[model samples]
Target chain A: MALLSIADALKSAIAEEMRRDPLVFCLGEDVDIPGGMGGAFTVTKGLGEEFGYERVLNTPISEIMLAGVCVGSAMMGMRPVADLQYGDFLFCMMDQLVNQAAKMCYMSGGKVHVPMVMRAPCGASNRGAQHAQSLEGFFTHVPGLKVICPSTAYDAKGLMKQAIRDDNPVLVFEHKLLYGGKRKEKDAISTIGEVPEEDYTIEFGKAAVRREGKDITIVANLLMNYKALEAAQILEQEGISCEVIDPRTLVPFDYETVVNSLKKTGRLMIVHEDNYNCGWGAQLGSWIAENQIFLLDAPIVRVATYDTPIPFSPVLENYVIPSKERIVEEARKLMKV
Target chain B: MSKLPEKERMLGMYRQMYLIRKYEERIYYLFLEGIMPGTIHQSTGQEACAVGMLYDLRKDDYMASTHRPAGHDLAKGVTLTSMMCEMFGKEDGCCRGKGGAMHTGDMEVGALVANAIVGGNMPISAGVALAFKMMKKDNVIVCFFGDGATNEGAFHESLNAAAIWKLPVIYVCENNLYSATTSIALTCNKPNPAADRAIAYDIPAEVVDGNDVLKVNEAATRAIARARTGEGPTVIELKTYRHGGHSRNDACQYRPKEEEKAWFDRDPVKNFRSYLLSQKLVAEEELQTIEKSIESDVDQAVEYAQNAPFPQIESALTDVYWEGK
Candidate 1:
């Protein structure tokens, strides 16, 4: 085991997969330029040198083309890992992603399939509205896409390998702050952890329990998971035991973990950086209502970003996005109920 | 002038072109008779473009198509029975009756489902070509689209990428003048919509008489050769026309009577048949025999589709994702 950052872990997984499979390749703007940042946050750093530029292909700033190429390649037996510079730019490739890649197999009547991985760095790092949005919620609603967010280094490498090998189009959402590599971005925080050197894979739809308790259950992902853990510590000091869960993948959501925890606590609170309107929290809350309503003793609460664009100013951005205090306060309120 | 290959090759091309012409005519009448469900963007007059572009393509070579895909699909080797069954929404249809008229294709025949969105298949073709390059295969992808697709951002972006990477893609733009009800002139000021823009991406562009199968085939052969040799992508705009309205209910009032008549006079199938006769490539009786066989084949396929059952309701829930090995 080694203390690897999420960026390094993701890079290692890509290298391992590329070495294992000849069909796996990477492409995007600045993905592997010699003197450029290998990807926006260095998730593909040093890969160009290791695998050659053919496999670590560099594309123009055409998001639609990059995404469409990935879909086109995957259907023809090439597994391409596309580096979507920012999660917000996914809109540029919406037609190819939603209408093309998502429906290719079904529309072809199982005659074709797209095996591709799209990695996008998301979360507010003082970048304005367009670059700072958490877009996992948007893709989760799209059928035929597997959306996974790995906050820790361990999960990042494991899930990335699984995503590259999986027979479906997987969207790996990485929080910018969680990428604790050498090319650290401004105002970014580190969430590095020990990662095994040997090859391994973590299955999708499995939730990681950061803190276990018999009190209210708090579920979060990406940056919000760390905030939820922080909130759990604060609430623990206040004699309010809380259970913290990190749902690794939003599409194949680990409702089982939350349900089991909710049976013990009978209370749930969802947290994320995405806005409240039609967010993943809303889906989970509704699912709980339909399937796990009996397990809850109190109404579900969601601590999320306000229904507004992520402003540039730290004061406004912090206020709009959920913080540790916000989660603790929301938990305290839910605890009372 | 590159001589016409073998008599056999010319005859095969003629047969494919005739097949597309007859199949589309059959489909047009089926829609008019209220036998086939859903709307159709029939390729009634664009027979030469499909046959010429796809005649020499190997079964392994891919051909991505637009919403108006019947001609391209048939020319690319999709079975008549499967395509007709697909039109009838039958279980054994190409797309299992899910992807109706606009989305008919069979990946096994190197024709993936046609994209309903304009220019949606351009970038996809580049990707398929990229796979062939990475896999070290000589196979190339022939992407077919319309004049309207040339204006889409996808077209520019994909062309630029394909040029930079020299991806093995032969982009075939069946320039049928009008996009639905609006004329291409209203949308793009350029005389040649697709070929003119190829200069922006540094790709070789050609404008061919789409009504002439020999000219279209010559251009396709050159483009396919360039792609196979890693010379990069080619944008070929074949100037053709649609004999009918854009879809089932279109009255085609948008088109000028003179323009429609002029295009009808140059109908691809009729002109090619005349050329074949003038060149003495085949006797009149032999051509008649081929046409007769095609008419009967289409009739039998229509009967097969009518007897074909609609897929079970539960099947709609499957194939949403393929767990292919």
Candidate 2:
């Protein structure tokens, strides 16, 4: 096992996938430019040198083209991993992602398949509203696409390789704060973990119990997973045990683990960076309400970013986004029930 | 100077064009009688554009089409039964009744399920071309769109990428001169909406009489050859007109009588019939025999679709995510 950052883990996964399959290639703005950043967050750094320009392509700053090209190429039996500079840029290719890529298979009566992956870096690191936003909530509602958020280096490499191999379109959402803090970006959460040197793949729709507890169950993803764990620690001092669950894949949600955990805890608190109304948490909460209403000790409590566009000011942004205190506070209230 | 393909090729093109015209005519009546499930964006007058552009494409070569896909799908070799069944929302349809008139295709025949959005197919077609280039295959994609699609960002973005990467795609825009209720002249600054915009992408462009199969085929051959040779993409604007409205509801009241009359006189199927006879390519009886076969074929297809069963409701849950290759 070697200590690897999320960026390094993703880059290694991409390099390995390309080596294994000649059909796999990477394309995005500044993705493969020599001496360039190798995508906005450097997840594809140095891949061009290994894969060559044919596989590691540099695209013009056209998000729609990036997404559409991936969909088209994938339909014709090519695996394209597209990189979106910022999660916000995904909105530019909304039609391609939501309509073209998602519906092609069903619309064609299973005659076609799009084996593609889109990497989106999300979360507020003071880049203001446009650049920073956990856009996963918007995509979870889209039926055809798979949404995965890996909070750990081990999960990052494994899930990325698995996503590349998946026959359908998958959106891999990486958090800005959890990009391993190696870059000069201010306040990036420095996270590095032991990733296996050998090839491996983690199954999707499985929840990772980050912190096991019996008092209350807390579910989170991306940066919020770490935040929830931190919140758990703070609550631990008060003898209020909390179980933190990191749902790696949002689309094929792992309800079994959450529901089982809810059975033991009898209380649920959903935490996320996406805004409050109609977020992914809301759907999960609604589903839990419909099916597991009797299992809940109290109504499902959601600790999410306030229902507003992310603000530019650091104070405003921090206030808008969910914090450790918010999670702890929400969990405390759920425990009161 | 005008040249002609061999008699066999000429008749084949004529047959396909006639098939498209007849198929659409049948659908128009079905729609009027409320026999069909949904609205249709029929390809009535633009038969030659589809036939000419797709005549040379192989089964491995793809065709990306738009809302008006019947003509392109038939030209690209999608079966009549599958298309008819799809229109009737039958389980045996190309898309298992999921894709109605606007989204019928058979990928095995290299006809993609049509895109209903105005300019949605542009980037997708470019991606298909990119795949061809990446795989080192000579197979090209003939992407079809309308004049209205020219103004979309997907068109500009996909064209730019195709130009830079030299993707093997022939972009055929059937310039039927209307985007829904709006005329192309009102929407676009240039008269040639698609061909004129090719200059911005630095790609080759051609404008041909869409009603004349020979002219459209000549231009298509050049562009298709260029794409197959890895020379890059070409944008060919075929000047044509839809004999009907933009969709099922519109009566095409927006188009002037003179404009409609002018395009109707140059009807592709009729003019091609004349050209074949004038050139002695086929006997008048031979042409009549082909038309008879097409009418009967369409009639049989309608009957087959009307009798076909609906897909099981639970089947809708499938194909949302393909489990395998």
Candidate 3:
């Protein structure tokens, strides 16, 4: 086992996939340069040196072309892992991602498959509204696309490998705060984890029980998963047992695990950095209410960021995004209910 | 004057153009009779542009088409029966009844599923070309779009990327003069938008009379050769006109009568046939036989589509993702 950061884990995953299959390649802005930060966060750093420029392609700052290239290449039997400098830039290529890549298989009557992975670095950093939004909610809503958010180095490496091998378009939303790169965020959490050296893949729709308990089940992902764990620790001190569930993949959601956890805890709460209205948590809450309403002893609670765009100011940003205190408070409220 | 292709190749182009013309005519009549289920963006008059550009492409060479894709798909060798079945929304369709008229294509024949979004295929074609280039393959991709697509950001981005990477792609703009009723004059300020813009990307560009199959074929030959030799992309603007309206119900009242009449006078299929006869490359009896055969083929396709079954209701739930190999 080697201790790797999220960025290194993703890099290792891509490198291994490229070595395994000649059809696998990567494209993005600043993806490969002699002295550049391999992509914005260095996930693809040093890959060009090993694989040459043909595999690690550096493209112009064109998100539309980046996404279009992935869709087109993937359709032609080439596995392309496209990267966006920021998750918010995915909006620029919405036509390619949502309309083309997502619908190509369905539109082609399953004859064509876009086996590609789009990596978007998400979460609220110091960057203003345009750059700092956790946009997983928007992509999770899109059909014909698989969405995965990896919080740990282990999950990032495994899920990325699975994404590359999968014969469908998968969007991997990596939290900027959890990348654990050289350029650290002010509030970045400790995301270093021991990743196995051997080839391994984590299947989608499997939620990990980070801290199992009996009082309340708090379902979260990305950076919020760590926050939920922090809240669980705090609640443990107060004699309130809380179980934290990290749903690795959002589209193929592990509702079974959440339901099983709710069966044990008898209460459920979802925490996410995405905005409150129509966020992924909203779907999870609604699903639990519709299917497992009788199992719930209290109303399903969702702790998420405010609906407004993420602000630049640290104070305003902290106020909007969900924090450990908020998760703890929401979990306490659910316990009271 | 451009050097003409061999008699056999010339006749083949004429045959393909004739097939496209007849196919569109049959589809129009089928829609009129309420036999066809979906609407069509017909390529009634731009048959030569499709045939001349796509006839020489190998089976593995990719072609990204526009909403009006029947001409391109037929020319790219997508079976007429599959296209007709697709039009009928039957299970035996090329897209298995999922893609309607606007999205008709067969990847087996190297036709990427037709893109309905304006200029959506431009970047995709570049990417396909990028793949061929990365694989070190000499195969080229032909991207077909309208004059209006030249103004989209995707077109510029795609062209720039193709130019920089030296990807093997041909950007064929069938300048039908209108973006669904809005004249190209209103949207574009340049006389030849695609050709003129190709200069900005440092790529070679050409303007051809789309009604003249020979001229289109000549230009496509040079462009395809350049792409095959790693000379990067070429933007070819084929000046043509559509005989029918943009969609099923469009009367094309926005077009001027003199303009319409002038374009109709140079109908690609009719003029190409005349060229073939005048050049003595194909005898009148032989041309007539080819036309009759195409008509019978269309008739058989229509019959097959009418008899083919619709997909099961549960099949809609599948194909969202590739199940597996």
- Return the top candidate by DockQ: 2
Ten residues in sequence with the least summed lDDT for candidate 1 chain B: B1-10
Q: Rank by DockQ, highest first.
A: 2, 1, 3
lDDT of 2 at B223: 86
lDDT of each: 0.91, 0.90, 0.92
lDDT of 2 at B179: 88
User: Rank order by lDDT, top first?
Assistant: 3, 1, 2
DockQ of each: 0.83, 0.88, 0.83
Give residue A196's error in model 2 in angstroms.
0.6
Please identify model 2 stretches exceeding 4 Å from their true place. B1-5
Residues B222-300, candidate 3: write the lDDT tens digits.
9999999998999999999999999999999999999999999998888888887898888999999989998999999
lDDT of 3: 0.92
What's chain A's TM-score in each predicted model?
Answer: 0.98, 0.98, 0.99
lDDT of 2 at A17: 95
Native contact fraction per model: 0.75, 0.86, 0.73
Q: Ignoring the other chain, what TM-score does chain B have in each prediction?
A: 0.97, 0.97, 0.97
Give per-residue CA lDDT, model 1, range A66-149, as digits (tens).
Answer: 999999999988999999889999999999999999998888787889999999889998889999999888999888889999
Cα error, candidate 3, residue B243 (Å): 0.4
